[model samples]
Target: MVLRFLFLFLVLLYSAKVNSQLLTDELARLNNLGAVFDDLNNDLKQAKKTKSISQTTMAHYNLAIFCSNHRVYTEALHQYNNTINLLEEKKNDTLYAKVLNQVGSIHLELRNYNYAKDYFIRSEKAAELIRDSVLLALATSNLGSCFEKQKKYKEALEYQNKSLQIFYKLNNDSGLAIVNESIGSIYEDLENYKLAELYFKKALKYNKNEKNSRLASIYNNLGDTYRKTNRLNIGLDYTNKALSTAVEIKNTLEVASAYKDISKSYNLIGDYKNAYTFLQSFLKVDTENKRLQSANQSNALQHIYNSKEKESQIQYLLQLNKANKSQKLVLVVLVFMVVVFGVVWYLYTLKKRRHISKELDFKQRILKIELDKKQAEEKNLQKQLHIKTASLSRYSLHLSQKNKMLSNLSLTLKNSLQRNNVDLKRKLTELIKEIDFNLAQEKEWDEFMAFFKEIHPNFINKISNAVTSKLSPAELRLCILLKLNLSSKEIASILRLTPDSVRVARYRLRKKLPIDSKEELSLYLMSF
Candidate 1:
């Protein structure tokens, strides 16, 4: 009796230990899920504040998925409702269909068959509108699952086949695997074990490298088919594989289901002790999972309630702050208006002063231009006068040269006649008279006087007024040459006289002039 009691005590202790381990794992999973929801909630709040519709919708969808995974049905429904509302507002047909499909899945999980069917139908219509074959395939596959849950095998098979066709066309291996698994479940329900096994094998082939939960499900389902066909050893092998995968992923629900499947396989294979042990572990894990789920739901409800209360208080404080800012804005506006008016007046005055200064500058510029024009005109007149004086000096030298050449010719002719015959002497004398007339031509002297008068219009009048006595033509010519700054030798050449005679004439003229004895004759003539 003591040995039997101890054996019972050990079994009970083992069960309790498994329950504790399951509870601890479930709590850790819940905490992780809560962390994910917190991050998503914060993102949702920011997206709403910034008016980002797409980000807000995605946050809502992800939060719904998290709630669904934790079996928080009501909270999942609330988040999915928010996602659907935003998607409807944006009119995003493809994403809207996907959200509707997710909503259907949530309803399916809750066992609301009729509601799940309705949502799946709506999702199909939205997907069809956008011609999105992938979303349509998802909706169709979900509809098959809904029908399968309701025991409508024919309807489930039809929808699954339709979804299968789309998945083939799209080459969606994941969708194909899901549809095959559902079809296999439907066949298993109808007791067609061969067809069920065939589909399960196909699902396993397609589900290679899939998520741990999905692979675990496929292994568990395949093991069930093997057990139904009395292949107990093969069934136990698959079930053990499923349990290992489920435990590794920390999926408490799948772990419990795998343990139950493993226990059933052992029982069918005549391994009663292993079957009993696995069954106890399954019961312990399942019970702990349910308790954890209940606790998590309660915590989530309290958090939401607190958040709503805090939000209302924050809204009230924001309103008060907005009112205070409005009053400050009025004061700021008054100061800004005064500053703007002062700046405008200052700019106007500065512009007016600049305009007046510019006008004065313009007048001064015009006056300077007129003065420059007058100076240029005077300079041009002086240049013309200098050119005329140089021409007259050149003409005087030419006339003197002509006179000396004629006198030399006359002397040569007279000498030639005296050496030849007395009769030719009379003819030579006539020729000499003609030469003298040419040498003293009044026309040449008049032309010289005209040029000199143009250069020095007031010079002759000034000299005549300065001198006490009237001046001879020769003396006047000497004074003009001296005014031109000609040397005594040049003056002698011009007057057709010897240099000594020109010097004597200059001395006589100096004595006649009313000037200082030390002053030069050229300087005196220039001043006059």
Candidate 2:
């Protein structure tokens, strides 16, 4: 039994040393004097790292805030103190002053009024060092809170008013919310419930986010005010409001207070069943609070245990140091080989990328050359098409002018026939018939259509597709003339038809097409 007991003791010691008592990395760094921590802490390594603080002050501050907000006051205090020590050089800094004020606040929460007052005074002095108005106001307000907790109403009021004025000038809602709540609490203690409610309401108005712990506190204070004023139902409502908010925030202290207040309010209202239910809840929270208090008491002993564990770690490191010499040499060789391989691999990849880039550039150059060749061919085709279109236009114009001359000559011969003998009349009649036959000839029109098709390859096909029905030969002739943008009179001369008849044919052609009636037939044909 004695041997077994010794064995168990050794196992416990070894396990404790190995586990480091579950110390967080930031906390462990804050504790040790050594630069080296463990294998995974290579990132923490630096020249003269031992002399400088291991954990950054900001890390400590954030951790402290998290712990404080979570009701892990012991860890919060530890982090806050170490952070202050690390920040000793900048005692006048705004963060230093803020941290000092926050430390006092934790003490205030713990009801250590003397220590709270001392820290608040230190915080206020630190703020004064830099003349930081905001920090000064915060420290002043916190000092007021500390004094208020101590029942020093006059001093509390003095400090609170000074902070309140600053908060108002800055238009800082959060600061206003906190200071106003503090003032309201003072008035409540003084038996001035009306004034307390007024300030509490002001605090609530300024506090935008309802989830805030400060909001819970203000509601709780307001409930107390109403309860003292004998407004039982109203008081119960506010207390329930506080309880809901405190529950949402998971603030153990405020939650406990809210539970207690509810029990008392139910008791006052003769709701014994509800009162009993709330009393049980309050007791449970109180038990948890007592446990936390016990944890707080054990925190000092835990700190000592950390020191011993750190010493053990140091001894373990020393033991490993003797064995690491050969291991380090092997590690160095492996690292050198890795670096050599990496360099070779990098050069190979760079060569591959350059090869790929050159291929891409060559392909791009080939593509650009092909694109330029296509563009030049298209430009040459456009020039050839334009010359063909001009030749077609000139041919159409020559036909139109020739028809006009033939019509005039036929009209003159008809008037000459009225003054002549039978032979001359008969000859004049034959000549007029020949002129009329030439004027009505389809050859010139057929040639114009053929030449037009070459210039505008798909025009006839597009027109056929667009027309509602198949066109007559005369209508097709009119379409070609319209495509050439010829006026109605010019088309009349070319087709050997009167201008009025040409206009009538154009209107009939428009009825067969898909174009709007308001649209010019010539312009519509030209679009195709």
Candidate 3:
């Protein structure tokens, strides 16, 4: 009877421990949700004030997510690093895994595929150690996504299958649905439209609540698969479903993405009017999202607050100084009257007034100098910012152009692969090589000449036509390299030519351009 009572007591204790763990889990979820909402509201100040390490870690993680969604990658990376450090310090293995997953996602968005893969692998390792089925599933799915992006369909399928198995064992319906959709996406990529559609439909059947964004994504995927199979009406139907679901959920970002998909579908079907309509909607939504994000940053409000606070402090100091000076003047006048009577006091007062005047003049001069120095510093900072902004903008624009060109080149390369046409493959390779060359020398003499023409529009056509005849593209490239003070070997390496060829090109350029026999090309090029 006593043994039976002890068994009952042990059972009760075990039950209580389970209940406590459950409470802790619920609290953690609540904290994470609160942090996410705070980040969404741009309440960073309040988030930092929470004092809980978990809360701060979650807040930083959420802010990273927010920044990444808005394409502010540097800021996202900053927040992600902070979150990682905090989570690591706490030794919160589960949260650490989750944060690593988020970091991987950001790196994926940044196109740092290798780094993304590394982070995902680390996340999977943590999840495996913890035996956290949900996180393990998440890590597997994310790793699958990275492989899919790299076009490793077989590997992607393996990872996705593994994730699906885990999700099924855990009865994680949402995860199962997502893995199915991902599998379908890979099938579509492999050009197995029927198989893709089958998987997508399978996922849809389990998507009862329509609460998951994966549902909308799968609908869009099905639409794309149908479009590929030349089923325009079916594609339109699925795209419309996606649009409806996205809108119903008030997922503005997803809504914009849906509109973009719809536009592409219509474009594929040659329905220009419908395509244009959706395109306009997509643009409008995107612009509104950007504007909303900028507004949330509150840069202007913070600047104004900082300025007002500084001005108030300066005013308070000025008032204090004036009071101190007045008291000193009164004390001095009293002392002078006691020591030497009214005449001496009057003389001392005159002398003191003159000394004060001189001191005031000196202070004014010093203020002027300080003001001038501050103005100069402000101008320098503005100049530096302008240069940095311009450089960043140029880099961004260049990368965009390169991406477009690379996409075209990839399509061309794929076509060559399909046809098994050696000549076509060689030509495509040459084209790709030319693009790489152009990218490498994008800011060469040709670009400078173009820029020069922009500054001097009247002579543009004449100068351009003249320059074209005198300088072949290779010669122009060599000239630019030379102007940059690069050696012949460096120029050759850049242009994939021999040093002897570069020298020949330089000789030709000197003959073509207005350089004298004794003139240094580098000096002349930099003169402008």
Candidate 4:
């Protein structure tokens, strides 16, 4: 239960309360709700006082609907403006779109063409966003009405036909009635009375309500179309029916319209007496309507009571906004706190999880270090072994070259033995000296020394340090071979000399060293 409460609280903190379809349905039902101005005004004030935004919006919407229905356009326009203001910043797309359409309608009714078209376009976009076909159709129909009034017949028909198609597909009788009426008005304005009469009849056919003001309006339009088309008798007959229907519904505006249509129809038929009589009736009704509209302007109506209404309304709105400011701030602060708490809670849980894995992480790190140490030791041993193998191969190549040079010298000496005795002796002496010089200055010796130093990098330096005097290159070579622990015969063969001669060189090399004779020479050399 506690967990559930936390979840609910978080949900409330995060979620915005955009209005639902239920609010739209409620607003729709208010059109038929019979409430006077004073009652609706009271409802609006109470809703505003409570700071219930949805209720306030609905209240304003209801007031606007009633005012527009009663043809109190000034007040209706003001209320529609208020409704739009309240719904503008909301995420409630459906209700916002519907409200936009209503505001556009109010502007259209007032003949504020630019404002009406702008609002209709905005509503169209909002409808498209939510993919509401019904809202889309309604906005399209109103846009057609605006174009029609502006004398843009082509554009008016285009929009009207589009909306008509939508309404037909939806099978919406109300939408069909509205679109057909708009299309009829367009045709009527273009003086296409035949098409006008046809559409007006279609509008009547779709409209289920016979006693309503719309039926009276359709009758008036159809009658006017007939009067223009030279069917005066038929026009007079339909105009009388319009008057009857208007009188039945107590629609004062429609009654006035019917009277004017009848007067015009009578005039067209050359019936001056009937025309004059109906014209008088039309004038009386139209004058009374203007007077009543002027008289109806109260402190809230700007037509008569502009000053006090503006002052009081401004003051009331200021106080209402001031009161709402702190409430909104409080809500915002609460939301911020809840968000911060959630983040801190998440971090705390994450810390606990990290703590649980701490020992395992430490063990893994130790294993990684041990594996790295073994790998490093193995690499070091392999590198040393590779260096020794490379040194041995280089030394073997040097030995083979020396042996081949010695064999060439032996063959020359053997061949010289078959030459003339005197010349051969001279040649033998020169060749023997040259052979001895070449052995001392062996070309491969420098390269062998380089390879020997790689395998025993410090050997030559140690040999120099051991002897107080500088040794010849041959003595350095003797020290390196001793480090290799070669026998005397192997050293003699490598140097192209007798074993006894190699022993004499070794003895001479030892004499220049600082070591005791008791220490083994090869062992001493190997230490370096």
Give the top-scoring candidate (lDDT).
1
Instruction: Give lDDT tens digits, candidate 4, residues 317-404.
Output: 9989998997899899999999999999999999988986997899899999999998999999889878776667557545746775
Root-mean-square deviation of each candidate, in angstroms?
25.5, 24.6, 38.1, 20.3
Poorest 10 consecutive residues by lDDT, candidate 4 = 14-23
Model 1: CA > 4 A from native: 1-26, 32-35, 316-528
lDDT, model 3: 0.71
Task: Give the worst 10-residue stretch by lDDT in candidate 2.
Answer: 33-42
The TM-score values for the models, in the order shown, are 0.55, 0.47, 0.46, 0.50
Question: Lowest summed lDDT over 10 consecutive residues: which window, candidate 3?
Answer: 296-305
lDDT of 1: 0.83
Which lDDT tens digits does candidate 2 get at residues 1-528?
586346434533543343233223324433442332232123223312544554467666765775575456777899799789988998866888899899998998999988888888888899889888788888889889888887999999999999999989989999999899989989988988899999999999998475878988888888888888889879877887787676555566677788788788879988787688778777876776666555543553464356458868998998899669878888999999999999999999999999999999999999999999999999999998888878888898899899899989999999998984999999999999999899878887778778888787898788989899999988988998888889898898888889899989999999999988788889989999
Best to worst by lDDT, what's the order? 1, 2, 4, 3
Report the error of model 4 at residue 209, Å. 4.5
Error of 4 at 331 (Å): 32
TM-score of 1: 0.55
Ranking of all predicted structures according to TM-score, beginning with the best and ending with the worst: 1, 4, 2, 3
Residue 435 CA displacement from its true place in model 3, Å: 99
Candidate 1 weakest ten by summed lDDT: 7-16
lDDT on C-alpha atoms for all candidate structures: 0.83, 0.79, 0.71, 0.77
TM-score for candidate 3, residues paired by index: 0.46
Question: lDDT, candidate 3, residue 58?
Answer: 71
